[model samples]
Target: MMELFFKDFIMLWSTIDPVGTLALFTGLTARLSKSQKRKVALKATTYAFVILLSALVLGQIILKAMSIQLISLQLAGGIILFLFGLQMIFSDPEEGTGSREPGHQLAVFPLAVPSIASPGAIMAVIVLTDNNMKTFTQQAMTAGAMTSVLLITCGLMLIADRIFRVIGHNGSAIIIRVMGMILAALSVELVMTALGVQRWMS
Candidate 1:
């Protein structure tokens, strides 16, 4: 049981990828003020928590009703992440401030969905909490592990916000472009893995 708990923690940590999410958060919230960035981080984390918890509890049923496979979700999410990555890469880091939506809306988008509570994270929770495979206690332990990871993710985002606060716009611009490339590569990996093309190619 203890070993399983440890495994779950590591699994969730990889799927959640708090550092990756932190990069996305920093890049997305670059235009906002310090206080706004804080609120966005908190809100994105809260939203991710709610989303992952819901997936743990009810995702299987919902997916079944929609006749959707986890791989399909992964494919779709990968496409979206790739597009967002391209946007982050090409668009001016300091542009879009005046015409764009508010910070709270950003908390719901690429930040919350594919960034923090990613498709991999969602699939992981659902699989970990499968009604047939796991007992209630085991599922509960998995949930606890996921929660711990999310807390860590949130902490990292907060710390990143502080770092960016010091570094200012120029530093933020460079990292955002770098993270965009990373995100694009990540999305491609997600797609290939979902398609089971990895073993075929390499």
Candidate 2:
């Protein structure tokens, strides 16, 4: 049981990649004043937590009613993850920010939507909430862990000034590319699993 939960935790963490995305998100929000930065981080992460937990609690029924299977979800999520990974790998680091107005908000759209509460994370959480796989208590624990991870990510971004000074743009690029590779690989694996190749191998 412990081993199973541990595996799930690691898989969740990798799919989410909160730490890696934190660097990018912080860079995008870099121009905001310190207080504004903190506010955005807190608001965005709080929103992410609520959405994720809601998904975890109700995702199975919702997906079933929509006639969606976990395998199909996995495959779809993998494609999205791969596309995002490609963008991260090949695009300019500055591209995420685009053109910014003086009062542009960072907490709502890209930062919270695709960055933290990513499509992949959404699908992954939904699948992970399978009632057949574990007890409700275990699922709750998993949700808590995910929330904790997001909070930590927000904290890291809140201190983005000092963090960026240490790692710089080059370091950030390296991390993004590395995360992209991992995401691409996971995407492929999800496809294969959905195709039932893993069952054959077993």
Candidate 3:
């Protein structure tokens, strides 16, 4: 249904945070040549896609093996995401300067791991596609939505240089802080939902 699709899309978008990824990508690859930036963008997006898709497919099995409950996972994920959002809001811009170093695998390090295919994103996909609750077709829909968001992320990265020029570093920093606030609010909502606060209110 349209409602389900919209929910999936919004959840994935918030977790993926493509604009945040773009800001980081611009910062990390700022010194690279245009061609090198393109390569980094492609590789980073590819790595992130693989990581997220794998989590979507295998997360439930792994959680079951560990005897983890969905509500527990959601609460834990919300806490992690909130902390990460806080870090993004307060992190120093110079912290990522080392990523510009020669021979550093920037794509896999900050870009792929916590930037794009972030812990929040991994948790979100698992929560979205809980095997006990969602049908296979519904899970497939969530996967599709995730893929769409990643594709958009890649597109943004490819155009990151131009966007950076338009926005400048200060603009990028402002955007990152704003996204962090949004992410923090969303994480709080996730926690509240996990606690059944909405159901109680209803």
| Regions of model 1 farther than 4 Å from truth | 99-101
What is candidate 1's TM-score against the reference? 0.91
What is the lDDT, from 0 to 100, of the residue 88 in candidate 3?
A: 67
List model 1 lDDT by residue over 124-193, tens digit each: 9999999988999999999999999999988887777577767677877887888889889989998999
Model 3: residues with Cα > 4 Å off, grouped in runs? 68-104, 166-202
In model 1, the number of clashes is 0
Of candidates 2 and 1, the better by TM-score: 1
lDDT of 3 by residue, 62-176 (tens): 8789998757766876786688678768987447555454414778866786678876788889989888899998998998898889999999999878876787667767766
The predicted structure with the larger TM-score, 2 or 3, is: 3
Candidate 3 local distance difference test against the native:
0.79
As a whole number from 0 to 100, the lDDT of residue 74 in candidate 2 is 65
Cα RMSD of all models vs. native, in order, equals: 1.9, 4.4, 4.5
lDDT of each: 0.86, 0.70, 0.79
Candidate 3 least-lDDT 10 residues: 95-104
Candidate 2: list runs displaced more than 4 Å.
1-5, 71-105, 164-202
TM-score of each: 0.91, 0.66, 0.68
- Candidate 1 achieves a global lDDT of 0.86
Best of the two (1, 3) by TM-score: 1
